[model samples]
Target: MQTSPENDLVTIEEAAAMLGTTTVNILMNLKRNLLQGQEIDGHWHVSKASLAAHGGDTKAAVSKPLCQRSTCGSCGQH
Candidate 1:
């Protein structure tokens, strides 16, 4: 796809750093469609535009635990 300097693809790590968050959080955002990105050969590439948009949604880079937000099935305690 066509990419500009401001909209170039960034690795999950780089995206996380840019957002001051974690790679796992970025991956979860990707999975939940909370962020925009694509998987290439099993590696995730994030869109800079998407990252910029998400910036307003967060005040800080704190990561939330799954069970803290809603009923989580992963741990089976919720």
Candidate 2:
């Protein structure tokens, strides 16, 4: 789904993408009360304002590493 700045709500996935982080990071933030969101229909809906306050920019693209393998020990995926 497409979201505009005028939109107040965003999904957890969207929030993660905006922050250039993973969904698990967003969930951890939510659990720690670092980010604000509401659970609806088994999904977490985050506030765009909250994300912005946390330095999450919807227009900012995430930088990908040269290696995209989950087995990379540098990313703790191994």
Instruction: Compute each candidate's TM-score over C-alphas.
Output: 0.65, 0.62
lDDT tens digits, residues 5-74, model 1?
3456888888777777779878887887767888777788888877787555441522444445566453
RMSD of each: 5.2, 7.1
Task: Kindly list the per-residue Cα lDDT of model 2 for residues 16-67, writing each as its tens digit.
Answer: 7778778876776677576788887788878777777744343232222312
Cα shift from native, residue 77, model 2 (Å): 15
Best model per lDDT: 1
Clashing pairs in 1: none
Query: Which stretches in model 1 have alpha-carbon errors above 4 Å?
Result: 1-7, 56-68, 72-78
**Candidate 1 root-mean-square deviation in Å:** 5.2
Task: Please give the CA lDDT of all the candidate structures.
Answer: 0.68, 0.64
